[model samples]
Target: MAKKAVCIMSGGMDSTLAAYMLRAQGYEIVAVHFNYDQRTQQKELESFRAITARLGTGQTYEIDLDFFAAIGASALTDRSIDVPTGGIEAGVPVTYVPFRNGIFLSIAAAIAEKEGASVIGIGVVEEDSSGYPDCREAYIEAMQRAVNLGTRDETQLTIAMPLVHLKKEQIVAEALAYDVPLELTWSCYSDEAAACGVCDSCRLRLKGFELAGIPDPIPYRVKNGVS
Candidate 1:
């Protein structure tokens, strides 16, 4: 039997590319996505569905995390906290959801344990990220250890972060090489209709495509953003 991997995807380029890499390695992908009542929830969910269909996804977990809205601090969930449009700041940006990746990984662990999967795939880029603390490789590794300790001894799991250390440009180029559907991914932290290109997430994505010498397939309100 092929090894099974429960992939925690965000319907973004990074997660989609990570799942594609797992698929290329012959893992039967059990796709997982979370709807956390963010500003772009519907758009992200739409993108997740499209990407899964293309991957021939085995089983999908469309988990709704509504509490994030109530515990809102980040701009994505809180209407009051405006998403930064100036540029990528020197410190942790306002878009960083509090322990968001940690929570997602925990839920993904439960799904992986229930599904009898051996691996849990996440797309967390550290080197080129917007300084989200939870996106750090060390934090993810610690989560993996904690997960193993909490699960049944027989139900061992490997937390796979294939893009943890990669730059956004490398990710963009790799996704192109794999022929991943870039158009189906959504990265905007604010707008649901057209991506606000000035947002940090959008800026990074645009920068990646530029560095990779490829035009991003997704529609952006303005292709030019803060460098």
Candidate 2:
């Protein structure tokens, strides 16, 4: 029997690459995406479906957690707060969705156990990311311990963080090497039709492509001030 992996994909470059990497390792993908009422929710959902179809993943989950809108303090979930366009900031960016990865991983653990999957893959980058606290390696490890302690005694799970230490450039390069459909992944925190190139997320993605010497396939509303 082939091994199974429940991959928590956000339809972003890093997460999408993580899923593809798992598939390369010969694990049957059980893709999972979350809809938490973010600004680019629709675009992300569309990308998720397309990416999974291309990957030919097994049973998929499109879980809705609308409570993030009500619990909104982040710019992605609350329109009141503007997503930063200047550059990546010093500490945790306003885009941090309040332990969002923690919540996502918890749900992923449930899916992994129920599906009889031994692995749970999450693409969380610490160094080249937008400085989200929940994306740190230490935090993910702690969450892994907690997830196992709370699950069934016989069910053992491995939380995989394939891109935790990689730079955005590395992620982009790896995705291309795996023939991942980069255009199908959405990274803009706002603006679904065309990426707002100056936003932190967009800038980081653009920077990655720039450093990788690859042109980003997605359309951007503007091309200036993307650093």
lDDT of each: 0.92, 0.91
C-alpha lDDT of residue 110 in model 1: 95
Top-scoring candidate (lDDT):
1
Tens digits of lDDT, candidate 2, 127-203: 87677888889999998899999999888899999999899898999998999999899999889989989889888
User: Measured by TM-score, how close is model 1 to the native structure?
Assistant: 0.97
Q: Candidate 1: where are CA atoms >4 Å away? A: 225-227
Residue pairs clashing in model 1 are none
